[model samples]
Target: VSHEFKTPINAIEGYTMLLQGEELSPDQEEYVEKILFNTQRLSGLVGNILLLSKLENQNIPMKKTEYRLDEQIRQAFLSLETKWTEKEIGFQVELEEVKYTANEGLFMHIWINLLDNAIKFSPSKGTITMFLKQEQDSVKFILEDEGPGIEDDVKSRIFDKFYQVDGSHKAEGNGLGLALVKRIVDSAGGTIKAENREYGGCRFVIELPKQKDEII
Candidate 1:
């Protein structure tokens, strides 16, 4: 199914890219830009669906290794600079130097999805803060975003498959990101939770056990 849909989607995206390079009226350009955006979104959705399916079937193998946690987070944030910059979002990073043994590729999905959500729901010019603290035997990773906090009713199922707070299908995501994140974290023996901040917005906290021997 993924291959079948992605074939045509890729063709559409290619054509859109070509169209974008051509000269057009302001209205025509606007329409083309929307098409380009939706096409790229569809491609992403297809890829996520394929990945989640593999994860559910346990077909993806885990390659756990010791890696610098702070560096990983920094790389993820840098990768999404374009997204946050486009929305005028500011970031406050307070990452402590730490190392952990985990599946680096799978672990990256957690940071990417959480950071993506922070930027997605946050209002323009809002602030997102990330703090990494080393506990006695675990690491506490906290991400706070200045967005509309989750409702009491939806908090329980926020990580469930295909569960989107905005059920109108207007949002960019197909709702599999958080589900994937939860699964990956669980596989790594980590705990993740979401909470509404007292002051405003929402916070996602993840605690992962630290390995005794740290690999440089």
Candidate 2:
């Protein structure tokens, strides 16, 4: 599999590097950004697919490390600042001082994918609210977006691979984002669910155990 995929993947990397070294218009930069994002995503896609296979067979490696969960999420927000700012979107973040033990690098994907969704379907000038805190025996995270909520019928299958909501934003994603999010959450012995917010828009909630190792 590696030999079969090497040539084309190298070509993608070469062209991407060329594109990055040049000056570009905002539109062209956006195009390059998408290309870069997808290229990186494609590289990880194979591993994630394999991880899915591991998940089915009940083999997942949990390399836990201590890190500030609040700082990581704040970095996710900062990383995608341009997208939300362009839409005049506002963020209401309430992150209590909380530390979590998990795969430090891979967990960032959870926040990035979810925040990208919130920014994508959000109305102009909308406010996206987020909260992360440790609660008793579990840590909780919640994100709410001011966009059209998911339809009840499609809600059940939203996390399925290659399933995109049938609407205007249908063309926006390849549908693996949420699926990957679910994979990481599940692998870490956590729970994640989606639902419609009471007033309007979408809500995603996640919970994870607070305790890790007794030796620590």
TM-score of each: 0.90, 0.81
lDDT against the true structure, each candidate: 0.90, 0.84
lDDT of 2 at 118: 95
> Which ranges in model 1 have alpha carbons more than 4 Å from their true place?
none
**Using alpha carbons, what is the TM-score of model 2?**
0.81
Runs in model 2 lying further than 4 Å from the true structure: 1-7, 16-60, 212-216
Clashes of 2: 0
Worst 10-residue lDDT window, candidate 2 = 207-216
RMSD of each: 2.0, 3.7
Clashes of 1: 0
- Model 2 per-residue lDDT tens digits across residues 1-216: 734565686689679879978989999988988887777666655555665666567676667788888999999999999999999999899998787778887799899999999999999999999999877778899999989989999988999987899756665676778898898898778899999989999999999877755122
Pairs with steric clashes in candidate 1: none
lDDT, residue 124, model 1: 98
